[model samples]
Target: MTTENPVHLTPELVENPVGAYAGLRTRPGLGHVVLPGLNAPVRLVTRHEDVKAALAEPRLVRDRSTIPDSEMPDPQAELMAQGADGLPPEYAQYLSGHLALFDGDEHTRRRNPLTRAFTARRVAALRPFVEKTARELIEALAEREQADLLGEFAYPLSTAVICALLGVDAADQDKVCGWIRDFAYGDGSRVLEGLGGVVQYTKDLVTRRRAEPADDLVSALLADGGMADDEIVTVFFLLINTGITPPALFLAHAVLALLDHPDQLERLRAEPELLGRAVPELLRYVTLVRMGATLYATEDFVFAGTGLRKGEAVTVALFAADHDPAAYDAPERLDVAREFGRGDGHLAFGHGPHYCIGAALGRLVTGVVFEELLVRRPAAPELAVDRADVRFGHWPGDGFHLLSLPVRL
Candidate 1:
């Protein structure tokens, strides 16, 4: 509460979030601060407990006009949603638009429609196909002696799963992957400025699916008729793209974590019982999406003695909150078997109604792939690319650019 200068979580800080979040939390004020180049002043919620409390608060809106733009990058989400610019108003109207950015009756209405798509029964049905794909990719990588798991493994794995669920052509997975890259690569400012014509692609795809329905989620939605075209675009944007980028990055980090902690890897390898717990541990340890997207204050509100002004933007940093000393004891230390949610919940996925809908599916895909990654090659290969040398065409959120690694294949 005492700091004068605003804290900006820039692209540079995202590269190594462990230190960045740690350093940001230790500043003079944890509640609020401001940045210069950004459009408006921001209030930064540094601690995990506070961020959790804020995510559930209705007063904190996602619209830019509700919150200051300087603190968080997503204000345009409101503008985009409102059709403030020439862009369609319903651009973010889908499940990816999901509950994360929505509120109350409308949020429920939208989510209720798509809830079944991600149910355990549905995802379980697709596991055989997912497993087959993972093994095939691994086998292909083994043949080459190197493959970037992000590009070659995690990216396609997540992409294919979602696309398949949506009933899109599995062969078009590469094109969807490219669109996913353009959407969240951090360079994108809006549907128009950043992802030029990206929305149009989603529209065209949905139109085609509607013209000729298929066995996918998109076809089902078209049959249901609750979703509008632009809304479909938004849903497609979120569903087909988001969520797994972090896991892709986390996959790379998990390997790094496991290699250094051979005992942990040995435990998982020796007994598969540890896979589920290990997944959370790896997420907790790697802690992707260092800074969660911004949220605006819809009206005047206060939390923990911090008086927040109306329309001021604030950040609920997921990484900083995840690693807060108060949230998790020795959070920096990675323990694969540690009981997550029992001790302290991790915010790798955002909290509350807006939580990542695909979280379970994402974890499922990542776990299956990770399990196969180790099984396919017992000795994790040395990444041909240096850890420091890797870079995503986009910034942190795209996941690390893990293009290739020299494995013991």
Candidate 2:
């Protein structure tokens, strides 16, 4: 069905998604909006309660195969088919089957091994290393009077940490980071090629890990026999891609948010321990990974009193849900000390079975990066560019990335 006045997910809305989300919340719980590059209308779940309930609803599945292709929007299939051409059929299928696209037992099977690898103990064990990496990056930034924090510090820091975790070589970091950056923001014309490069690189890495296992997450995953070589490659690609960008964006966003709220910044500086509370708040406040949690209805179901036909796409606006007034007090404010223990935690990492596996690590890395930057930096960083001048771009479904965040140390 076509929308009469559909809300397109444009760059402007992406820049200020919360504002759009707020307007949507005023409507009925589940409303329809037409996104660009798609032929069908998407059921946008905006309210906090409905969003939370929808995320956990078994009727809304991730696997698209459950529904006939002709029943859904053409863009849905195009998005899945992306980057699959010119590759072996098996590899192509693997490329399309990311963890987020799986549900039920299949999702569990694919996700369990990785979940085991990123246990709390494992994340905690990496604290010292994360701290060391953050310190080095901050030190290098200290040498320069002015630098783009996103380019110079956050990106490299995140890439280095993920490389260390995945057992990727230091020599190949620049190459990998470049590929990730391109794939994250490259226009449609080049994204497929960029993804091909990443897939090929991951294949090589998986082969090397198999031949010579190392003390890293990739080697550990290889040691586990449940996943195929292609599955391993896809999982590795997802891990590195997901691991690097969100945390990097979060770091920049956290810094930007804190800087904007000097009172919170001073409070954090005065009490470093407040980070236990602060990090969660930043995760909620920044909400860097905006949109693109797409799910399909498995059968006829009533969602928020709306009759969702089979194969219809449901896109949850997490940024809007996190800012819902019913969920939190002063939802728009960036209160580092806000208490989140009482209710459902922030939807930044998402909700339900497909919740991000790298969440703990992202938090650990971000927390360490913020702690070191605040504690070790000789002076707090001031924006080198005007706040209004900051530029943003999104790779449709990946992240709303800051193209540049120049700052004076």
Best by lDDT: 2
Residue-wise lDDT of candidate 1 within 162-267, one digit each (tens)? 6677665767666665666655443345435434445666677788987888767777677777777766666766664465555666676677677678887777
What TM-score would each prediction reach against the true structure?
0.79, 0.89
Please, what are the lDDT tens digits per residue for candidate 2 over residues 1-409?
2356667666456446457777877876567776544445678887778878888999888777867753665335655555454556634664566888888999999999888766687678778888887787777777886888887888777777776787778798778767766665434465556676778888899899889988788788888777887787787668755877678778888898888999998888887788888988988887776664678888888898788888888888777777889888888888878888653368888888988888888878877877788745656788887888987765543336677788887
* lDDT, model 2, position 256: 89
C-alpha lDDT of all candidate models, in order: 0.64, 0.76
Once superposed on the true structure, which residue ranges of model 1 sit more than 4 Å away at CA?
Answer: 1-4, 8-29, 33-39, 65-99, 170-214, 342-344, 385-409
**What local lDDT does model 2 show for residue 265?**
87
